[model samples]
Target: MGRWTGWVRWGALGAAVVVLVVFLVAQRQSIDVSYGRSPSSSGTVEEGSAGELSDATVPSVDEMTAMVAADPVVRLPGSIAHWDEGLVRNAIGDADVRILVAPPGLDKDERGRVRDVDNAQLRVLGTEVTGSIYQAAADDLPSWRAQFATGDVTSLLVTLIAGIRDQDTPEDVDLFRWRPPTEAETAAIATDLRATGVHIADGATLTDIPKSAGPAFPDGGALYAAFPQQTFGEPVPEYGPTLAALFPGKPIVVIYGSWIEYHGPNAADFTDVVGASFYGQAADRISTYDYPQANVLHAYLNRVTDVRYAGLFERPLPYLPLDPLRVALPALPWLFAGCVVVFLALSARSLLGPRRGVRSTGPPARLAGLTALAIEMSGLTDEKSDPALTRGITKLRAAGDALEQNLPDGHVGKLLDDAEAELDDTAWTLGRNDYRPFTYLRGRLA
Candidate 1:
């Protein structure tokens, strides 16, 4: 029983070791959990409040419609304009603009601050470069209306787009929420982006914008913003994945003769930073020469398109080279812990099993009898001898010669032990046979 118990314990121990090895390899291949939050906040929008609309601040759908219909240039809410000043200033440039904020109810503070200015829920409505007006707004208006309590603001947002669509504006409306970091939120965001295969250098500045909702053509397959005269670091391949990861379904806006600007951490060095773009002195030449007629880089939407929006989707989406460790993540550590415990328990059992002295190193004791048997039969011969028996006797003689070298205990020792058993059987058979002098034994005596 104890012998069987030892065997069971060793088997269990071997299984535990194998399990540990497999789990360790999985851990290495797994992506980091640090980038747990998705780069894009674009998702299902919540329903708007049904409470009475604020007559003082909230514009009725008709009023908003009329406002956009009357003029092409209008100022945005202070709360909204802060996202990206350049977006409203240069990108839009007095074109009729229509905006949509998710969870449509807009509340004003005593200081007139708009409280519902979240990046995930806000959208700027625009048409194609060919002057295609509010077509995008028409498609999304129903969804927007479903979220509103009155649908009046929805009408206003829709009408705003319709007005832009009717106008022959030369520029498309674009705006982003750009700001300098007053806290570590930006740094934490940058860290998260890095884990998703984005290469962010030390002291490099990072600012992100939410996905854009527009009907622009799929240019380079993504959307990015270009700030004037703001050339950032050298444009690395990581920028596409990083940007796509952040703004999954948006296009990367490119400005001719410009690059993104990065600043030092110090406030005095113009620490105000927002958006990402290619960097380096070479960027100056590239942007100036090659990008002058560049169209927007179109990207896949987080929900509307595949997750590999800007990624090299050589493999399945889940197996992205840098995919995060999301598989069995909550249970992996526990499994490893369990394996370790099992391994320890099995080790303990092995330690408690019967103790033995150091392994013997010389030839097995049975080698002497085997050698004697081989010598006695070496030169003996008989015409009626079985061919198999003759071969066996020859092999045994060779084993006997090899055994004299004092081979250390190991595989050689094990092989010699087998030889001994074979030789002993042969010797017993020979003793039972009617042997004749100077001849090998005949069959056992009948």
Candidate 2:
């Protein structure tokens, strides 16, 4: 086809796609849907009135242990505690492996604080996360940070744990961590590290572990977040499926951006902390543990039978600008619509497909195996065999080469080559039968 004709057809299709996009944009403006909570509190309800309506006191590690004991099988992540309490406690049967990742540490810059405030304001100490977990405690952050700085406080907390449920996949696990710790703030950093069981550097004193140079570990601990498929040092966005693929039937543990919490017990405010969802569907999967949860990470060697969302560090992967379709289209139905359009456009382009570029303007070329027998068994060449015969011969020679590579040891390949050679000879003979007629197609081609 001419270039002008191709452009005209393409322009028409382009206009249609634009119309669809515009219609979707307008439709999106009319309604909005999001995976989790909007940062705004203008219209939101409180989540997690689970357990009891008792006083909301910060839980102690011992109390956290008792709570875990209540379960039939408390599955832990390699990122949790250093050992499997299930094997240590309840290992007979009914072991439900509830996978989880390390919780996030709190760290937000002005850009993050501004984004949440001007947009959703969903961050810790900035908006609803503050209101939900520590509406009462947030006011005392300075005191807490100071208490943390004291270096004398044995245990510390921000009191942000609450009811988490899933709005998307109920089976999906959820996690929330809006805070982290500096070396001194933990006070018992040595004990905490031991709980995670990450090896302390050999020949190094406890003072060497947190003396500012970095944790003096020998080869890093077993709790070092062993990859279910530890191909990526930090959890990356694209690693979700790759992790799933590697683990197969086991669950998926996602640590958004591999936040700071992976290094130690503490850090601060992150953007996509999973537990912030008052409405995030996966809230029911949220699990909390005292510092002892490090055993979960220890289970990484067991192939991580459970999957979890640990917002440790809470630093979300850089928010990918949502696709125009995901943000605005009638996606589900639009999928069918898109398929229909694509099929039609392809079909139209095919049926009306340009003819000049056609490799052969005739019936399919002959299979080499059939050619030799056909040449010997039938009219070797008709009066008009030149063009068709030439094309078929060319195709047969190609098939022979393809056959050689594809079936080097096979008997069929040898047969195919032999047949092709016979056919080519017959075709050559026929093609040589020429006529003088200038206009007769058979003679003209010859």
Candidate 3:
């Protein structure tokens, strides 16, 4: 009985330990899908309000210009040339700003421009550059947009190619002899531009211009003024299941540039930072001298500086909901460890606990053998007058009574009852002079 009880206790403890191990292993292998919030608010933007540039406390153009001209210019080979630095400095005067000259064709070579901006000592708020209007009108807009998107600035330059002459020789061209982009083309281009997060500037210029060309474009100033006040009515496209799977819920913002005619109708809707272009007859001459024209750079600086100084670039962080499973997953390891500790403590106690020795209540096993021996020895004597046989039977019956009172109620007790019955039968056979029972009993005992 004692041995059986010990086995049962050990089996239960072993089972508990197995369960704890399984739980700990499962927790260690579980997947978590939640993400934490970003510390900086720079790249993060809220949903549905991606392109909003509203701020009542925006600085004026003069204030923005002063702020922008303070910083040194970061120039690239393909960017506005070194010769044109004086023109840019003259326009910005002594304000703080970092200007990066990144042309469309110079993909990775533009790294120096970025580094220069980073090295500047001023409060470099943002960067503005003139991209090729021709390249943007073509399919190269995506790559250009990608380059600007990776920059620290929130906006970029989107030059317009509509109504601009593409003549190779500046002298033989007519400025008025140009065609505007159709409404369909403009809408399609606008959609694509928005997808790339490119910021557009109004008042584009002709591809070819002589040094004599002045700021004679009719819509140049009006386009610039209307840029900040224009709002787009087109709905942004859904990212779809494939993009969602790839990026989850990543944010996208598009910058737009348009002529006064194109965005004038919605000008009142956009009451935020506006972008205007200074590239026309007067500005084109300075930029055409194997370098980005000074007047064009100045105009870009003025507009971009205004936007930056007005605090329109900083956007709020997108709100991401906490995932319940992800939050709970982290606690699993701790819980598992605690359960294992408890199980081990319990097992240790059971193994090292003081044990109570079990005592037997039934007659000793050797007594049964002795009783059988006595019966066999008496069998040789005559049954009618055998006093030894009578005494042996009486002793066996007394042993049976003691076993019935003291033995546990199980297999051992049943064996005791059977032995007592056999003893009575032996006595009866001896009394009747039937020697067969005694003979069988003696052989079984032997």
RMSD each, Å:
21.0, 23.9, 22.7
lDDT of 1 at 394: 57
Local distance difference test, each candidate: 0.33, 0.29, 0.33
The lDDT of model 2 is 0.29
Lowest summed-lDDT stretch of 10 residues in model 2?
148-157
- Name model 3 segments beyond 4 Å from true: 1-11, 24-74, 78-183, 186-366, 369-446
Off by over 4 Å in 1: 4-56, 69-446
| Cα lDDT of model 1 by residue, 309-359, tens digit | 323222122223544555655565676667567657756644543121122
Give all TM-scores, in the order shown: 0.22, 0.19, 0.24
- Cα lDDT tens digits, model 3, 91-207, are 344544354433222212232343333333222112233322222111122322222222211112222111122323212111111234455644554454345422243432212
